[model samples]
Target: STEALSLLEASGYDYTNIELGKEWFLLGGEESVTRVALSKEVESGATSLPKIFVGGQCIGGCSELASLIDNGELDALMKKAGATKKGEPKKNTGFLSFLNL
Candidate 1:
């Protein structure tokens, strides 16, 4: 989880970290079997630790995040999600900018 957090920090986009307790489940209501089913929904059939979600969609764990960074897609994803780098002001674009608000 620390490694994942490091990668995200280097990416410069703000992120939220939710450290689930050992007893917490990702999608399962309260049963282990349902947890297995949740993993299946992602087609991995196994949940990876330190899962990352962007724009409310799961993008897999640390390795996946690394891959996105390596391939330069992470920036695009963050931009699309309207995420700005920490300490940077968001640029108003399109209709909002035209309105001059």
Candidate 2:
């Protein structure tokens, strides 16, 4: 669980509002949009752990996040997750750029 959270934080997630599951699995409220999206992924049988979702879509887990970051797609997802409004300029955080939210 410690490691799971560390990975989430390192990926720039704000872990405060999210509740951890019984075994420290990341969880959202029963009605959470992300939870629904992640559930779809699980139901579809994706063999990944630590699922990630944003803007009502399952973006995927740690490996997927790294790939998206490397490919520059993560910025858009961050924005969609309310990191910034459509007309807002991206915040300038030195090392952890996307964590500005």
Candidate 3:
């Protein structure tokens, strides 16, 4: 989650809503909610935490996030995801805002 934290920090995102991702287990438990949902959202053999989502879309973790930022696509995605302007503050509606179940 270190890499994920760095990426989010650089992007000016607060990690409070997503800390649940790290304290998770796949087994039956309350901690699994965020992790389980994130795992399913990512269409791959495996999904890792600090899964980045914008506009209710799973954008992958730190590496994928860096890729988007490098090509300036990150800004585009943020805009499409209803990101606010500078000084306007971005409100994270959290995992429920993206996934139905």
Find the candidate with the highest TM-score and give its number.
Answer: 1
Error of 1 at 85 (Å): 0.8
lDDT of 1 by residue, 25-53 (tens): 43444365534544664546556566676
lDDT of 2 by residue, 24-72 (tens): 2354455555445445655464533565555445555666667886798
Considering lDDT, which of the candidate structures 1 and 3 is the better prediction for this target? 1
Model 1 error, position 35 (Å)? 4.9
Regarding TM-score, does 1 or 3 come out ahead? 1
Residue-pair clashes per candidate: 0, 0, 0
Ten contiguous residues minimizing lDDT sum, candidate 2:
92-101
Q: What lDDT score belongs to each candidate, Candidate 1 first?
A: 0.62, 0.49, 0.57
Superior candidate under TM-score, 2 versus 3: 3
TM-score of 3: 0.63
Q: Which stretches of candidate 2 lie over 4 Å from their true place?
A: 1-4, 11-38, 41-43, 84-101
lDDT of 3 at 98: 22
Rank list by lDDT: 1, 3, 2
